[model samples]
Target: MNYNIVMGTDNKTLNPLVQQIYQKIYPNIFKGSKDIVTELFLAVSYDINEPPVIDLSQSVQLKKEDFQSYYTSELSEEELFLDVQEEALILNMLSKATFQACFPNINLKLKLKDTSLLNINIKVSAKVNIQTSIEGKQNYLSATILTADLEIKDAEDYKKYIDELKKYILPLLIHVLNKDLLDKIKLPALTFKDVTVSLPIPVVEKSFVTAYSCIGARQPDTYTSLNWPAETVFAGIDSHAIETMAAIPFPLKKEKEFSWKIISGHVLAQVFNPRAFVIQADGSIEGKIDAELLAQLTLKKGFFKISFGPHGKATIKATFKPVVHNGRLLLTVKDLNIPKLDIDFGIAKWAEYLLKPLSFGLSLALNEIFLPLVSAILRQIEIPIMHFPTISFEIKGITFNIDIIEAKTSKLENQLLISGIPSVR
Candidate 1:
């Protein structure tokens, strides 16, 4: 994986101050403890995402007199000065300091080129560096002490440090990336027509049997009274009943070539416990229908119908023209009604919220009060019935051309007869 780090606006401006603070507070932060210095070094190194890759080559030497005399001794008593640079200590604190300040919120972008090689990039700005001098003196001697000095070699090292830091922060980065992508993308819509459906019907049979037996009297002859002798009787009967049914296959065999217009739309019917119907997307209506069947099908011109409810209760009826041509059935419809109750419920509220909030409220109120009444009416209507709601759309007619292939007896006995068509490629 290749990784890159770019500096944010704040880091560039605050870096210098951070350096100065670290230098001045380093000794105090350690509280005169040697182990404190070691810990601080390790902490900074770790903060930069790079654990100590190399062992300390040398111990950090602290010049007590250089820093102590400035804070504890007075130079005003005597005009005293001395060369304190020799006593000034040089510690490898810059690398650690830089790593500590930059590691936490470092922005890293990584890309994988291949399996073998990894590249990393980092950018950082706004670095603050601070230097301070302490004055101390002995009789007739004036001395200036250099307190602290720290530096980061270059941007490349900073980039490297950031790359190392990513090992620990990669999970967070991935999470952020996913959230951002999800917010920007939209799910695609499902649309299509030419739907082939299969249904199953079962056939079963039952039977019963009867038998008879007679008991004979020992002293038959004249005392038998000519009795028929009580007889045990058995009877039998037979009946046929449907048990389980496999799916009935109908390939929508084209009976004739025909052209028809769908006036309304397509409907999808579903049966639940009770029953419910929904209108699916207009785009879902598409099919090559037999023209003769289209004419035979009774659908209001320019309209489509579909109904469904609980218990697999469903009915899809549309009016179009069915034409017979070359012993083939062609059916066509302009509109389609696909029951999409699930989708409609979600979209209804969305539309109300988006387009007309007041109307939405009124619609909700009407539904609550009249929904049950409408449902009762639907249940009472024995014959297949369709309900229509007004919707505005440009009327674009669709035509379906189908070829009738063959007719066959449905596996569901004589109850269902089906014509099969060759599968469309």
Candidate 2:
């Protein structure tokens, strides 16, 4: 299974990345004049009047589909949205139109379709895409722009002015953006040779044009078996405790018509050596165990007598559901079961003692105590997965961090996968 280390980009990130690119090409940001085909010597120059906003007319509210829409410009999917209004355009409409129109402001939006290249300048790109990468030695993401466009939406009369502006402004914007974008997005991913970054159907917010790009990844080879850090589970489980226990014989007692035996021996409380935790492809956890049962017991027909064992060992296998409560990560044990109950002394020494009780009665002691015992050890000791940290990777010496939230486990082929929402930092 492929594990995706998602890297998200937003305005807070985009603005700065684009800024560096724009800065290098500046000093004069669209304060000039142009002669229109109508012999209109329009000398239009303006300064930033109001700062850019996502959209003052409304607050940006998005849905899950907003980030995965098929139609470009679906919602809040563009790479950047900069709606800027200069103080106002001082225009000289030369010739027959030798008059200055009192314009409120020149609304120049550097609105990227996939999008952005923002400034007070009236030039924008058409479509853009930010994607994950497993190819790089260090970085996690690679950003690319397909095309760009700028809409002088309110400046209908300024058509001639815009046409001339695009000649130089647009291409310059695209070049700078392409260079900077590649360098800024650096996210870390599991890049084992066997692992693959899936290029599934590209899903991202709306774009103005058609452009598709996607990325995914798989697990590192070493993940097949993982051991719990604590090294031990429950109490008194060590050495060949199993071999010695299995050797004990169940003592038999004679009775009228029915024979009986009272069993007493050693048993490991936990099902297995909890430290040897192996996560299965199906998400089940099987702990390693060297198991043997020791017993001396009395039993006849449908009834049996039994007590605790000290040398015996059992096996505990379970599935885990990773949960987060109040920001603290936890593995809630689920489907806890005992796969092998090979107790010695012949039968099972059981949890405590089951006198004349049915076999199901034996489940009462071990079943009840086993699950909680293992779970408590993990929580109390602060196991590693319990405090998942912000994942980070570097690119060209720059480091980027992604916080994993709402984390849960999933099946990825034969590997254990823990996927979560990537909250940007």
Candidate 3:
């Protein structure tokens, strides 16, 4: 019996499915990662029986009279018969089928492991066993079989040509097997989306003041005996007042549109007062006089209120300022009023009278006490506060705004530049 076979196998049935699998599997495999096909090839090898034999010295002859009769029209020339070999005919047909199946479009030779023939018409068979895994650790196996019949033309050509086929065919088989395994597994999909964020505006402001107080002074007397015996002796005492005020305006405002949770907040404030007095030999005071008052008299606190509407409208208002009068400086809410809310603090009755004046006065006193000490120490140590005698303030507030503009999905292609400090949670 004469036999010949061509075998082919692909796991994916549909063209679209094959393309999808190719797209998904190609990346992972190309990324230098381990793949099922690579693993399988490393695990097994193809099995072939005894090596095929070819003898070039043998006479090239038609195997049977029927062979000549069958090809009479094709081989009309009698001299051409000498070129024909019985073994070559069978080997060439088998080689062609295997090459076509494995390489598809490429032309290649086949390796024959066995050359013995039992009949004029040769029977050939090809088979492949592949094992691989798609989802889990366990590997699955698949097998294919191909059979065909071919007529031999030359026995010598078959012997020398078949060996060349073995070297190239094995790799092609592995490639086909690998592609099959990849088709069975599912791959992960990657996606990206655009997100919107708001930026916060920072506002900083500053102000300052100066004030004074009174002190008593005494003078010593001198006695002289002499002529008139006036026995002059003089002693006198008097009280006089001096005035000085240091006022600093420190204001801070920050506004942020909220979408996600607030991440971080920080606030800092500093106030400084520097004063000095020079006493002449005549016992007269001439320099800066520093006085202390209630803490509220010099300190001010501010608040921010934000309101959000269902329709996504937002309103933000801030109430804060500083007050300086007659060498006295204070920070009070009296300067702040929300007319729309009908909220008002009379000039004298506001929290300013309670906290602002006291804070201010305390601040002034602190400056009076610390400024001179600091200055004196600095003079001795050669160090300065650098930015002293200035008041600084900071406040942080956060509110959420849920009304986000519906962003178009396809617009995500544009790269987004998010410029802002994200809150720390």
Candidate 4:
């Protein structure tokens, strides 16, 4: 399991095969409805040192040199001023847009009339305030509020409501936050079953080991085998998600020891050829625990049912650490040793002194029932874990950012190597 991804040089990294992401780059850098009529005439035009409120019987004449001649600045000897490289080229083309593909028929909203006020509506559409009546017909603009709210109050009127929500409520909150963080850039998946870990009975007497009662078994269920083959590289400089992997398997069977207690007497084990290994350095997961136990002794003091010869197998060597309490992610079962066991036939030499104290009480109840039955079946398997497929942008006032960064997986070309960086926060 080795994954590493961190891309963001303007995202667009792809070609792991064929390649495709041209939806005509969204009308070639957004031209939709002529950029919503130049962002509703620069969100209600501005840039004035004075001069605005007009009403000359019906005509059009409200310009601050059409918003300071679409903002121009030089001064090193040329003289101009409203920069940020031309409002960051219309805020990076309305941050890769979405709000219904940038306003065609408008709708934008953002309420909260209480706690510090903050409204902001938009609506529009019906030929957006049509007008042309001198007798020529077609009429509709005379300010009947073609839907346009605003409000904004705290923080010193937030820079005059972000300089009039950078023309059209900051590109409709950067295309509705680039479609809500491009649907959270992918990552999900998990699974598990037949879990019932419970072990204790240690009381080693002369050798000394503690715990003493709690036996249970049944942990055979799996899922979380993954693969994404490849494809999903976008790079204006970086963006990735190719070759994903998470193949996990755990097979432990021995007639799933139904259940048991003490007193009356009855034990039956069969753990054999159990091999596991996943030591990413010290993350732990070592295995090898062959087994086979059978008992039924109650003797002259009370009960009896003797006939235990399967005491013919034992070979330990364990370790399965991976613990993360509180937020669970366990697998404890560290360092357990058995070495060898195959008693000497003929009632297995007095049943190896009554199965050496019931084989050290089933090895301290299989290491205390493998951490809460494999951490409650891996917290009930979830999924997505970087499925990849996203794109969105915007960079100033009405925030929005995400352009891939880190995604790795390549179980021999199963494909997945995504990484980029530059959009933190």
- Estimate every model's Cα lDDT from 0 to 1: 0.22, 0.34, 0.23, 0.29
| Candidate order (lDDT) | 2, 4, 3, 1
Q: Write the per-residue lDDT of candidate 3 for residues 161-236, one digit (tens) a residue.
A: 3332333333343344335442333211100011111111110101100000012111112211111101111111
RMSD of each: 37.1, 18.3, 38.7, 22.8
Q: Please, what are the lDDT tens digits per residue for candidate 1 over residues 1-425?
A: 11010001122222432343334333322111111112112211111222111111122233443334334444532223234443332222222111111222222332322222222333222111112121221001111222322223455555554433333333233323223221222211110012111111100001111011111111111111111111111110000110010001221222222122321222222222111211123211122211111112112323534221111121333222222233322222333332212122222343333323333443343233232332332333222111111111111121112222332212211111112332111
Best candidate according to TM-score: 2
* Maximum-lDDT candidate: 2
Tell how far residue 71 is off in model 1, in angstroms. 58
**TM of each candidate vs. truth:** 0.15, 0.38, 0.15, 0.26
**How many steric clashes between backbone atoms does each model show?**
86, 35, 61, 43
- Evaluated at residue 154, the lDDT of candidate 3 is 56
Ten residues in sequence with the least summed lDDT for candidate 1: 237-246
Query: In model 2, where do residues sit more than 4 Å from their true spots?
Result: 1-125, 135-139, 153-157, 189-202, 205-321, 324-340, 345-425
